[model samples]
Target: MRLLITGGAGYIGSVLTGMALEQGHAVTVLDDLSFQQDSLLSLAHHPRFDFLQGDARNPDVLGPSLEQADAVIPLAALVGAPACDVDPDRATSVNLDAIRTLLELRRPEQRVLFANTNSGYGSHPDAVCTEETPFAPISLYGRTKVEAEGLVLESGNGLAFRLATAFGASPRMRFDLLVNDFVEQAHREGVLVLFESGFQRNFIHVRDIARAFLFGLENFESMEGQTFNVGLSDANLTKLELAERIRRQVPRLKILESVTGRDPDKRDYLVSNDKIESLGWRPSYSLDDGIAELLKVCRLMPRRPYRNI
Candidate 1:
């Protein structure tokens, strides 16, 4: 398979790219290098790997990449609520506008696997969100992803994966994600002040996200023209519960709750991954598995800029 991955040098993208390469697929990566990290450097000598440094919003980049792609994975974006909130214009341009551009320009035969966020089901703590759940996005980031997801599904050749809050370590690591953030904080400060600690959310390992994309690609015939919630079934956890999990790995980590506190992202939803799991995909990494791995990395690289937003 020939795969074109936009923002393929990013945290999840880098992981996906490597996975695809290992699976004997030809991979092309298009990334703007906005984060200034050389996460893809290790793949420089791979025979099947190709990379183009560029922006997804630019037709000059998208046009040529789409031309060579058998499957297109649009991963480029100003990801997350905090990042999107900081620059709404750029967020809209990358997250929403670029997707519109892809839909308009992509060939009918080409397959598109879009990266959508579970954040779209905002603040639904009382219900478990599925692909059938109505989107109630609360942040600019989530809203943009929701709008983009609609475009992909309506385009017959496309498939959208509404991803849960991803939380495993990646080559291009991120500490902004809840699980990673809490674990890192506990390692560094030994204390954490949590707000909206009772908010529940779903999580998936980063590598599992990559696997879901591959699963969608391999089963594109049955999965096309649909949206699926991709997440770990056993990993639905509240913020307070997540902290407790982290504390188990990093002992003596004091957790302070603030009832008056608020989470700016405001994403609180328990998502079901049964829809995708039925298609023969399952997550291999558990919360404990990820934390154990992160703990080892923390000891090796104690202080690196791992947060994306």
Candidate 2:
């Protein structure tokens, strides 16, 4: 398969690119390198892996790549609530409008697998969120993804993954994600401050997320036109619960709750991955596995007075 992955140098994309190449698929990454990350540099020498630098929103720039794609995975977007709030216009353009561009320009036979966030689901802690859940996204970031997801699903040739809060180390590392952030703090300072610690959320390893995409590509015919909630069934956890899990690895870590904590990303839900699991996709990495892996990565990172963020 010839895969064209937009924003393929990102945290998730870097892992997916290598996995696809290893699986014997030709992979082309389209990344702006907005973070100036050389995450795909190691893959440059691979015969099956190539990269192009451009914005996903530009039709002229995106047109040529669309022509050569057998499968299109759009991973380019403003990732979080804070990121979208920074520039609402660009967020809408990249997150929502880019889907429009792809559907307009691509051939009907070209399959699209969109990356959507589970944050788009309104807080339903007591209830399990499925793909059938109605979207009530509070933040601009969530709203854009929810809208983009609608476009992709309605297109009839696209599939969407409502990804859980991804956790784990990647070639292009990120410490901002919940598990990675908590594990890093625990390993480095031996302490962490919890916010909305009681709110439930699901998690999947970053490598598992990459694996899910690869699975989607292989099973596109049976799964296309369906939005699957991709997550670990056993990994739904609260912030406090996650910290406690990390504590098992870093025994000296201290957990403290804030008296005045109000989280802006109000995404609390116990997501069910049964739909995809019914199709035989199961996660290999557990929450403890990610915590242990991150503890090692934290030890390797250089320490400064401040965080990389």
Candidate 3:
């Protein structure tokens, strides 16, 4: 398969790029390199890997990239709620508009596998969200992804994966994610201040996200026009519960819950991964597995700006 991944030099993108190559797929990565230039450096010598440095929203960049693609994975976006809120315009353009561009330019037969966030479910604390659940996005990021996911599905040859909060270490590491942020804080400062500790959410390792994409690519015929929630079912936990999972690896870590404050990314929702699991796709790494890996990597690379805003 000739796979073109937008934002292929990104956190999850870099990981997925390598996985696709390992499976003998010819991979071309379209990334602006805004976050990091060297994220995909390790794959520089891989014969099947190709890198294009450009913004996904620009037709000059995206049009040429989409031409030879057998399948397209749109991972280019302003990822989190905080990042989107910080710059709504760029978020809308890249997250939503880029999908529109790809759909318009690509052949009708070219399969699209979209990276849709589960944050679109908003604050559904009382019930577990499946693919069929109504969307109630609270942030600019989630709303844009929700709209993009709809476009992809309506295209009739696209598959959307509503991924849970991704953890674990990546070639392009990120500390913005819940589990990654907490674990990094515990390791660096030895104490984590928690706001809205009772808020619940599901988690999947970053590597698992890449696996989900591969699963969809292999089963594209049956998976097209469907949305699947991808996450570890056992990892649906509260903030405090997530902290404890990290503390197991970092035993001296102290957790302080603040009663006066509210979380800016107050996405408290339990997600059901049954839809994806029914298709024989399951996450291989658990929260504990991710925490252990992150702790080791954090100590090895002690630096700032490892995260995207």
Candidate 4:
């Protein structure tokens, strides 16, 4: 299969591209290189891999790239709540419009796997949400993702994976995620700070998220127009529970809990991944395992500021 991954240079995109190539699929990456160029550097020499330095929002950039592709994995967006909130217009244009355009350009038989967020189920009253869960997005980012998912599902030839908060180390390391952020703060600053510590969320390793995409791609015929909640069912941790997990991993690190209500992006919802699991997809890394790997990587690297833009 020939696969085209937009935003293929970012953490998740880079990992997914490598995975596709390893499975003997020809992979092409279309990335603007906005965040960091070094993420996909290791794959520069692979014979089956290629890249286009361009934005996904521009058809002139993406049209030529999608000409002969069998599958399209649209991962290009501002990414995360903070980044999307920083510029809502840009987020809508790129996240929503780009997906609409991609769907318009795709043939009926072509498969598109959209990277939707479980954050779309923002602040659900129900503790655990499945694919049928009602959306109540509280942030600009979640709203855009919900809208994008609607567009793809309406198109009738795509699969939407409402992914949980992803952790684990990637070539393009991100400290913005909950588990990664907590582990980084604990390891570098010797203290982990908790804001709105009671908020609940689910987590999966970055590699496992990549695997979810593969599962959807291979089963696209049956999975099209279907939405899957992707993550470990047992990994839904409160912000405080997440912090405690990091503290356990690094026993010497100090844990500080603040009640000042500093969290602006208070997305709290436990997700159910049973839909994807029933389809034979399961997460490989547990929260403890992911945190330990992140700690090992942080110990080997020089301390740096954490940024995800």
lDDT string for model 1 (1-309, tens) is: 999999999989999999999988899999999988899999999989999999999987899988978999999999898899899999999999999998888899999999999889888878988888898898899999999999988887999999988987788888888888888889989999988888998888899999999989899999989989988788898888989889888789999988786666688888898998888888989989998988877777788867766
Model 3 local distance difference test score:
0.89
Q: What is the lDDT of candidate 2?
A: 0.88
The clash count of every prediction, one per candidate, is: 0, 0, 0, 0
What residue runs in model 1 are displaced by over 4 Å at the alpha carbon? none
Worst 10 residues of 4 by lDDT: 300-309
Global local distance difference test of model 1: 0.89
After superposition, candidate 2 runs with Cα above 4 Å error:
304-309
Question: How does each model score on TM-score?
Answer: 0.98, 0.97, 0.98, 0.96
Residues 1-309 of candidate 2 have per-residue lDDT tens digits of: 999999999999999999999999999998898888888989989999989999988999899988888999999987888778888898899889988998888888999999999989978878999888888898988999999888888877889999998888777788877888788788778899987889899999998999999999989999989999999899898989988888888889899998677656797888999999999999999998988888788777746221223
Q: Per-residue CA lDDT of candidate 3, range 1-309, in tens?
A: 999999998889999999999998999999998875588899999998999999999988899988889999989898887788888999999999989998998999899999988989989889999888999988888899999999998887998999998988788888878888888889999999988899999999999999999999999888888899999999899999988888888899999989877656568989999988998998899888888898898887797657676
- lDDT agreement with native, every candidate: 0.89, 0.88, 0.89, 0.86
Instruction: Judging by TM-score, tell me the better candidate of 2 and 3.
Output: 3
Looking at model 2, which ten-residue stretch has the lowest summed lDDT? Answer: 300-309
